[model samples]
Target: MEARTKNVLEPLAFLFQLITGILLFVFVIYHLYVTHLAEHDALSYEKVVERLANPSFKVAYFVFLAVVSFHAFNGLRAIILDTDFGARNKRAVDVLCFALFVIATAYGSLLLISF
Candidate 1:
């Protein structure tokens, strides 16, 4: 039963990783262009605040943060699963990865909200 469940979830997890990877690529390129290639004045403190004041921008930025955090930790989980380390303690690996993901995403959210 456990093996059957693992088989079912493995494909879903792979698909999730693929989708998140694509999203991260798009989000990162957009972020880089906005933060780095845009006019210097575009990133002024006031401008940043004004941008975040828009609800759409705020929601999109939060999604970006969540996607990036999930992708990073999911990748870490995949790497761990590929090694002997995870074979002995798969549940621990999953718990650690999830905890880190939550912590990272929460921290980023706080920063965005408080800014």
Candidate 2:
């Protein structure tokens, strides 16, 4: 018996979902610890500004922003795709979802970097 290959788009979307999920998980943990459980003094507004001022921190924040939005929108798309309504409109759905991701990344990066 021969194995079947998936439609290229489905596999790509699945891969993106998996990768972003893992990224979101790791970033979320780090963010929670930093925001909620780290040193008390670091919780100050000025300290937060100082942290965000770091280039590494800015990069991490942008990554977190992009991954979170993608993860959320893609996961939602996956859920909806299981329904009859979604099945009939895959192309439109994919395009809309991609647009959403782009828009989110643009807005989120602005907010993340302008710190």
* Winner by lDDT: 1
Indicate which candidate wins on TM-score.
Answer: 1
Model 2 poorest ten-residue lDDT run: 1-10
- Residue 49 displacement (Å), model 2: 1.1
> In candidate 1, how many Å is residue 28 off?
2.0
Per-residue lDDT of model 1, residues 1-115, tens digit only: 8699879877887898899999989988988787778868778889889888888877889999999888889889989988998978888998999999999999999888886
User: Model 2: per-residue lDDT, tens digit, 56-112?
Assistant: 999988888889889888888888889898888876777888899899999988886
Cα error, candidate 1, residue 86 (Å): 0.5
Query: Which residue runs of candidate 2 sit more than 4 Å off their true CA positions?
Result: 1-6
